[model samples]
Target: MRLRHKPWADQYMKDNNHILIQEPFEQKGCWKQLFDQQERPLHLEVGTGKGQFIAGMGEQHSEVNFVGIERVKSVIVGALKKVKAKETTNTRLAYVDAEDLRDLFVENEIDHIYLNFSDPWPKNRHEKRRLTYPTFLEQYQHILKDEGEITLKTDNLTFFEYSLVSFSKFGMTLQEVNLDLHETGDETNVPTEYEEKFSQKGQPIYRCRASFSK
Candidate 1:
């Protein structure tokens, strides 16, 4: 997705330093201490596009701590605004690359990982760039607790299939698979901005839950 240049985005991020983590590497393994409930389960959202999903999840599950990491400054500012508006104390936003997961978190630090509408990187040559690639899976397994799981939701069918295969190859067990999420009328399912837009256009939404422990 092409993002419009926001001249003030950098400054805006600095302005919200309290909730927006500017230097995530420094807080590695201490994320729980950043929130009011230090013992709450910590959930990390890989690519929080626009922030609607993470903020909504925070409001829905107060017992869980949410940290949304988005690399794009312009795109992340939008998410920061949503989180700020919601004032969800258990949630925080971070501006960092997914590659730095190891630098920003320790083993068994995360309870769950969320991948909402992540870029498919469709080309065969770009497979390594996909979030479900082995490199990322290894990092996820190292950081997630024994029972930690990954919850993925996307509108792309090919990407969904590819992710399932990737997870299976990595020895991750698929706990749940939903081909048509909306059709199931699962009220507990929170919709991201992209999910709402695509579903409104009559597109099917695919979701899967895969545990790190095989």
Candidate 2:
């Protein structure tokens, strides 16, 4: 995904305390304590495009501490803006590369992981870069607790199919799978920025919830 550099994004993140976690490794296993909630199950969105999904989650489930980390600082800034406007107390954002994820989270630290509209990395040679690849799934394993769950939403059929194969290849058991999510009429579904835009254009949304057992 192409992203424009926001001249003030860095400054905005720096100025807002508790919104963007700086040097997240320092808080590794105890990240939830950073929010006012001392003890709560933690949920994370690996590539929160614009924070719509995560922000809604934070607002809806105040008991769960929600964390969103994005590789692109400029794009993450937009998520931060939405989160800030809502004053959602149980959420935090951080700019971190997905490849270095293990460095910032200790074993069994996360309860659930959410992936929404992540980059597909279409080229076959670049399969390693896809978020649903085995390498990334291994990273998720290190940070998730026992029987941890992962929820994914995407509009790309190829990537969705690839992810399903990757998940099963890595011993993940899929609990729910929906090829056309909008048709399900699930009221609990929270649409991301891209999900909303794409669905409006008559694109089908694919979603699944899978669990990884230790």
- Name the top TM-score candidate: 1
- Over 1-214, each residue of candidate 1 has an lDDT whose tens digit, in order, gives 5779999988999999988988888899899989989989999999998999998999999999999999888889999999999878989999887565888899999999999998999999999998999999999998999999999999999999999999998888999999999999998888999999999999999999999754
Question: What is the lDDT for 21 in model 2?
Answer: 89
Off by over 4 Å in 2: none
TM-score of each: 0.96, 0.95
Where model 1 places Cα greater than 4 Å from the true spot, the runs are: none
lDDT of 2 by residue, 90-126 (tens): 9898888755678888999899999999889999999
Local lDDT at 33 for model 2:
80
For candidate 2, give the lDDT of residue 35.
Answer: 74
